[model samples]
Target chain A: MPHVQNGWYLAAWSDEVGRTLTQRWIAGNPVCFYRLGDGTPIALEDRCPHRKFPLSLGRLDGDVLECNYHGYRFDGTGTCVGVAEQQDKPRAATRRFRLLERDGIIWIWPGDPDRADESQLPDTSWLASPNWTHVKGVLPLKARHLLLVENLLDLSHETFLHPSTIGNAAVAATPIEVTTSGPRVFFQRRMVGVQAPPFYEKSMGLTGLVDRWQDGEFHPPGVFLLNIRLAATGTEEPEGFHMKVLYGMTPSTENECLDFYALARDYAIDDAELTTFQHEQQLSVMGEDVDALEVQELMYATERRRTVESSIRSDLAALRGRRVLQKMLAAEAAEESGGAVPATR
Target chain B: MAPAARTAGDSGQRIGSPGADEEITVDVVRRRSVADDVLELTLVRPTADPLPQWTPGAHVDVLLPTGIVRQYSLCGDPGETGSWRIGVLREPAGRGGSAWLHDHAVEGTELVLRGPRNNFPLVDAERYVFVAGGVGITPVLPMVHAAERAGRPWVLWYGGRRRSSMAFLEELGGYGDRVRPRPEDESGQLDLATVLAEQEPGTLYYCCGPSGLIDAMRSRCQGMPSGSLRVERFSAVPQPAVEEPDGGIEVVCRRSGLTVAVPPGTSILDAVRQAGVDVLSSCTEGICGTCETTVLDGVPEHRDSLLTEDEQEAGDTMMICVSRALGDRLVLDL
Candidate 1:
């Protein structure tokens, strides 16, 4: 492992650990999982310090995980408690990772634990609030997580790759605007005379609009949000619109990701039906993304990276997103060498 | 991290409880379609995870990518740590979470599961009665199995529009004389009165299904002790029609300090977002409980339909989507 910088790598979803020593490989190391009786998720090295046997093969006793093979027990912090034979050994321990749960995802810092910053973790407070009806789903892609991230940053492919869903055949000619910032990238596009899909149409009604049309933004490393508005009939000051946000965090494994999304619509806040309608609509849109992304992953795995030289204005966001990611990666490398990384355009 | 900021009415405070925040990944050793539409997904992990663990009478939320988090019942043998089992019913109304499992998910799909967390777990009782309707059988199905294995006397009143819609019919038969399948009944009605009248002393009644059944059961079980009868509904209660707005209002998001004017034709959430507050929301229908936040000051017309009488009485929370302030201005915890 290339001493991953002190950043958050999604360890597991809040739904993924138990007392049973669940196993997952993140960044590169294998992690054995456990949770306290009160339901706090934790991760420790998979290899037993004693015999190198995978700790995942063990069992859990209350807050402690008991190795099945030799009957060794360890707590949430990865402190060793019992040895099969040498029960009173002074100091036998295993490497433990720092795990934090935020917005339904358990994040781990598999690097220098002291350098872990809880404040740097991504915020997902929307998932818990009742005003939002959100769903957190998973998909194991065939391609590497980095490739998937790249694909997400690239929006020009929608013209060809997702022609049937969000992309329009005629819209390919439209130019896109792209921008880049520190560890963040933005892709923007403006289209005319585009038809609204079910998700958009339904959400428009809830937002107190008649017919709604759209605009979009794709942020780097897996955050996609779109701004859609109501279609104008007579054009009387325009009704309303919304910003739907989708974020994907790929896991320790190269092909898996935890997708977090939220659809903030414009509608009467008190109308229950409108909220449910938005939820159902967002669900369908997510399904569409899953169908496309999973297949995209499969195709990338089967074929070499295709030349992406063709540039459209709308693709600016995707390009900027890529540039930002490259910058972040270079900065990380420079920091490792005790040198400041120069900012790039 | 101010202590006052973490007070009871803190809008940012976690309502999912401390337990609502856990996630566990278990390997699926075996996954089989036990019924036509029902699949028994069994997650097998080393016994290091505790056994006879927590999941009481409700479902645990499973996190799947593509932004899908679904709730499923713990149908497998709850007593065994060898595996955790759940029965998933694919609904046409599914938002890809359950549909993905039905179409794409299979055995060996590593499941990242959260608590067998029961906002609706089973409680101790002298006698137990279970009423399951359609996929609502998820939580009850396992309870019946446990009751049967433990030699506890319980009857399963399972209803479906037709026999085919009801999952685990074969399993229901295994309940023997205790199960009453209501497939033939007109509109598949469940006579909770008849069932409740025959209730034995100290009997605990459990009902899971559509709002109608739950409402019916709740009314019929009125004679039972408070909290003696439990219920789990798949969908939220129906919301009332929104009347034509009399006037526009103003919303102030406490955290972001953004204020927006919500005209009669607009929702408070929309106005707040327009002001760049960027509040997180979903299912703008007010049912999913995703946008619920603390009310700092306002008589929120209390529009959406999810909270119970108790939750509303608590008045510490309000669903921002599809709900609005009764007065001209409202302050929110955001």
Candidate 2:
């Protein structure tokens, strides 16, 4: 939870938090989720204010959650409704976080409720659009959230990390343009005449020398999107297979993250065989990233020795991503020191 | 720090993208003040390749060294293929677009430019009434010359703060009686109402000026013949207050067969990019004529300053960058 970014973060998949007291730790804080009688989702601080007992261990009686420890009951808004043997409930209440559900994902804001603006959230309609098909899963990375963010921003790692699934030698060799417009950082690369990677050739039957492009945009803290396009060489118009690879990296704890990823495409929205192949291939590719990042984090957190690292031209986007994160942290730190913002707790 | 989520995609999604624009690199051969605040620059290709031919009322997007793009009318002779000329007015209140050229554009300076796009084209007419206000005369200058070459009867009403602040007087010196200099210091405002009332059977009015003048002309034009008035605005027409939700409207691209949900924060240009259809775009600011899409149905709230009053009311086409639907559904010919 670097700098505790002040906006909506994906707490779980839309289907992951329903019909039960689902508990999820996001950015170092615990939250419990449940649905009302009408199917509207709700999230509240997991800890009971009385004895600090986890509210997720309680039972949902219609819309109120009855704490298991002292039998205290709370409504969907975390308002203490019943105190077991009393009527007033001793002014006991738990923090209620704002939640918004869209595109098969549920987002929770772990900050000031008045400042939780939904427009700051990313667009992921393709994840659930009838016009596009996707294969998605949640990867529990034993690494910080920024590790996933940097990994996605610097995609040259694909050539080494997942060479068998979606990478090629041309990836590391191709040059990319790194630019920034305010808080947004962009990495764009275009290859006019190159052999299609084996993964792409077999997965989509791409043949012959082709023109390919990789465009990346990073909106710091939680989201990263990569758009890929491929077309035959000498084609006047760029008509080809397109992909929008989306990553919703949510900080679950200080040392771990819940990385939700989905690969949505414009073509083959109705192909069942392709969906199965993509699901398996995605698991394999993401497995490689999770394994690599887990080992990297082991070295980063446990090692007594610190090693110097050198970056090349390909690190331009990653470095800019780091700079924006640092800038946000610095700005937030300044704001906190000035004592203008309300306390999160 | 508040987090913002933007799904990154093709380079065409950039705000500065001269997408599919015919870009030309030319060196400034000459720069001279044509009016009190107007500067004229002559550009020529260093390699002597003939530039693309453009008609009268055409303008080019000058990508200044500072990355600010401003459109200027091509006041030079369209017959000359080796060189191009443009007139720039230093707008004191503008966003430093014209002032950048006025201050930094020098002879021998290399610059990048795009397009000779024409939204205010000069069509054939038996008689032409050319109404130009201040530096708005740049496009009118070429139109009047084209009319003379076509042997058509044309009269130019050139109005400005004063004669010293008006451009192309020397070029109009030979066309005595046909050219009327209505400098405010001497002649008061040109009675556009009188000109509108005297619309001859075959007369077509070509007006290029500030919003006030263009609006006045548009109001007077309704009583006159339809399709008889043509206006070019130097800036965007003021849009009404935005009151849409953040969830966005649904845009269906008929030709591409792609449907996209355009959230309020995302532009229609980027939304179309999500469906893998990159509509050609230049200035996403609603001024440049690129990224214009045909509206099949649904009322489009025209936010662009490019379309004339009647064109907006007609509602056949829209600038996708800054405009959206009046309801939850919009169909576009991508």
Candidate 3:
């Protein structure tokens, strides 16, 4: 199935793109990202539309790109504005994807331009909020974006996959409950009087068997958020630290993804040591994930037989998320083929 | 950003239920009365093929053809992949799962099962002390073999009502003094005081049996080092009622014209049942979603693991077995 074109997918971190032209792949389509002199992020199809020369290989002047092959200049909208050898710049434009830069991330919509809705953007205000201390990073994921989505949605695997970092017996041992609304899927695991993992024990100062909560939500096409709580077991009041973790799976191809992750905390807002510790530790953890997922991607591509995999309780959210995206793709296909009439045979 | 965080808007809610691993149909290759009133069945893959690998403390969820599901600990050798063995004690007063198995299970019987899930895994330790009571020996049997194979210094304290009624005595005889068989008729209650004295640095204690034995071990574990003891209950121990900090709440059973007060130190399930409401409940500790009740109004301060955060936040349905109302009042669909 093709990528969910109408949906907003994260393109690049705001600070990652500046005046320099950078070519990035999205849903198997290469797109160039750069900022105009006004510091506004722009996303345009990398091809020149004429000779299919990658525009990203060209030079940038103020607010426009000059193709390297023929020195053809195009505006931020991928509209060809000037040509060095030809008169009357052909009224041709490479595809321009809509871009939205909000909360330190640039999001792009590659579908029908008129249908882009800003309200549908995920709420990531916490990333820029002063009340939360955060660490963010990205990985060139070598697996289907859905696999990463499934990885985040199925927290049960954490106990096994991330044993040294976040995984612990309690994570997989505790069961999860799934609930969904519309195209969104959510699953929560609450541990009442359970032993805290080492990460929680160190970061949140949660020791012994503590009351904990982990809730995950998946927004169709590629957004995942986890809300975590660690509190003293049987505490009369909600007394503990809270952490908000986010994962963005932007599909670059069927076997490749751009994984964006950010972890924000309500406590230790000014603890630089903790920030550095978490940043380094999270990188190590994600490195392990990428290693496992890359192998999986290889298996997913070359496997010949129909595998006998089964879904259990913890897979409810992952399964539901896949179904929701499937529905979106089905609707798009039906609409695209709606007007075609066939001749009588 | 959410308008009251309602989960039922435009999106239908599906209550999550406990699901098992992929089902595997196996044949009951052999059956025998391991002990008085104790039935032992050996299961193998239908084609007499090797089964999935399992560890010491793993148990299989037997989904009987009658639609009833029961769990039995694997008692056979974990090294043997071609078959698995389980022991079931026939309880006359208990549910009919054991009775059905006792009568219907035979050499040719086919049973569908899920998992060999290990909740009571044997964590690596310098030394091990295994305490088993009667049928609980089923789980401990493999553990004994594992501890021996690992060359870990270990001892097994096996207890039952009578020597004749206890299973695995003949097999355990191979262990010599490593296995201590304490029949109640022969040794009066197994001396827990003597066992407690066996505690030492780097010693890990594992126990499984009736609530009495487990509770006793739990009480004595306080004197031992923290995390040194691990025990698996046959079923979820009844969770004691504790008042939410928000205090007691009034629940209106929408189907029935009755309002029940769930007070501090009282569970909503117990309170409703006490109020003459007959509700079906199983695994009352909240893992099973059998006691899920629809919430027509008011918020539920969810304490159960069966409902997702969105479901709890939606204030739609709740597993009343452990969850309570968040506010002072709740309207339930009964």
Candidate 4:
């Protein structure tokens, strides 16, 4: 999909960046990332010009990124400060990206830096507010970024996929709807006869009745939040049933993704309890997804199918997601080709 | 009239950094019985992948076949272009890294190793005092030899349970009168204070020993100038028991929404791992900064020797291994 060049992309959680230069991919290109003194994110081309060594193989000197191969130092703009071999100075500057920090998330402009917009990043005002706790983690997923984006949008799988936690056995889909707004795609799941799963049973206090279910909306590239509620009075009684899990999926590579999350809910759980609970849940779900999807990727490599088909109604949101992504990718490819016929019709 | 800077301002002056060394398969491995407990492993990399050149204080990160990595000091001369030398002290209570090196690893087995990075180096000093204890002598041995070659006034304070326990007795004797091999020289222990008293004005006191010796020297050498005293601790200092969390507390991993209960004996690190969070950690003993995690919230009982008291008090850093949550629970920025 076409990535917004100037718009913020989560580079890494603050905890992930340290003295060691870590390599991450953005928009299908590898970039080595490091943190500045105040935990600001900096991104540069992963390859060092001295010997084309991976810059992540280097070290961090305060704000300067040092190439591990020959101690070449590059500032935030990615201009080579010092090359160990003095004779190679005439033509040795690496490409630099526009890096920015909002809250604890690091963002990089992988495309045209001239058009990057720092203001477009999702408002993380919840991070500053009281009655909310946050935790940060980094997961190196062996799957395409689009695959992860689609995975989050397809929330119906949770009934079977996460049976013990966020799932329910009797929560058959009564109706599934898809709607779209500018830069946002909404996926709503409605379960008619849903019984409370054991974990949520005690937590929600809806032990007997059909606890109403509605998880809506998937904001493109990567942002998923379900305006969920247990008791469906149909109008405004859906207060305590909703949780906002804003996720940012930054592409690490063509075959890897870095998922950053911020969970804000109206629960009275203490900071420690909320933070640890969400962290543990994310880990379990991520482990399951990583195992299943990496294996799927391996299988996809070997099996080249001529045609793939599915009933559109059963999983309409997933299908629409793929179509929207195809359109974005086509537009990007056309722009790259100077307005030629796009990659796909 | 500009004052000459005592410390090197530029990063260029930080010597003994690792360079581009090709990954080589182990062509040969030789185990030597130096002491009753110590085992020396000599790994020969391919000629094409020439061993990474190292200085005296440098160590290598060895990747064993079992996927465990351990850092060991280069005991043999770093100047040697041949195989690299590392002495492994078989820690009985080790989490299988060193114990595997002592028991199972053998000759002709291929291995991956990261080289010769030196955080502890013998700086330019007029006179050197090398104080070593047990396997801690690995780094000091090379310093003793370098001091002897430079004709720099040096004394070796080697202490162990007995004379046989010392790693490099043969090399220490070459120093002649400079070597004070204190196996049991009587007078109730090799008093490091007595050794520090004879220090001249320009003398540099370098001590690589157990935590007790390093702590004692550090406390006694307080009056010495800042750059005069250099200390390296091989083990941890004895501290109070880590305060346990009350009951089995819930750790709300905010990013994931999964709650895991951390049992009394089990550490937060283990609990995090159990929940399947991928945290990069090393030297679980709290010395190395590999397991250094950012503290998002909660008062971290700083058990690690890596960060200073100020860093701990700032509530931003923590070592995952030995340290525990002081309050009911701690929310780590994983």
Q: Please give the fraction of native interface contacts (Cα pairs under 8 Å between A and B) kept by each candidate.
A: 0.00, 0.00, 0.00, 0.00
Give, for candidate 1 chain B, the lowest lDDT window spanning 10 residues: B1-10
The reply for model 3, stretches above 4 Å from the true place, is: A236-238, A339-345, B1-334
Which candidate ranks first by DockQ, i.e. highest? Answer: 2
lDDT (tens digit, per residue) of candidate 2 on B127-236: 99999888889888889999999999999988899999988899899999899889999989978876665667899888877757876776566545446777766653
DockQ for each of the predicted structures, in order?
A: 0.01, 0.02, 0.01, 0.00
Looking at candidate 2, what is the lDDT of residue A324? Answer: 63
Q: What is the lDDT of residue A114 in candidate 1?
A: 97
TM-score of candidate 2 against the unseen true structure: 0.52
Model 3: lDDT to the true structure: 0.77
lDDT (Cα, tens digit) per residue for candidate 3, span A1-345? 588888888888888899999999987789988998988888889998779999999999779798899878888778889886778687889888998888898888878889997866668999899888788878998899888988888888878888887878888888887875546677899988887777777787776779888988887787888998888898754568788988878999778999988988998789998888888878988898899899988988898984545455676677667756766777676668894321100
Q: On TM-score, who's better, 1 or 4? A: 4
Clashing pairs in 3: A182-B11
lDDT of 4 by residue, B1-334 (tens): 0000011111112343435233345653687778867877788865645576777766666666776656677788767768887888787665566777777767765667665666467777888887777787887787777777778888878777777777778766666877887775343467776687687877877776665676566556644554566655554211111123344545656676666678877766788889997766655666545566776555566666544322343345677777765445566776
lDDT of candidate 1 over B108-180, digit per residue (tens)? 6776766555545565566798888777787787787777766777888888877776777876675567888
lDDT (tens digit, per residue) of candidate 1 on A77-161: 7888876566465366789888778767677877678978675544457566555454444554444555556555555565565
lDDT of 4 at B322: 72
lDDT, candidate 4, residue A180?
Answer: 44
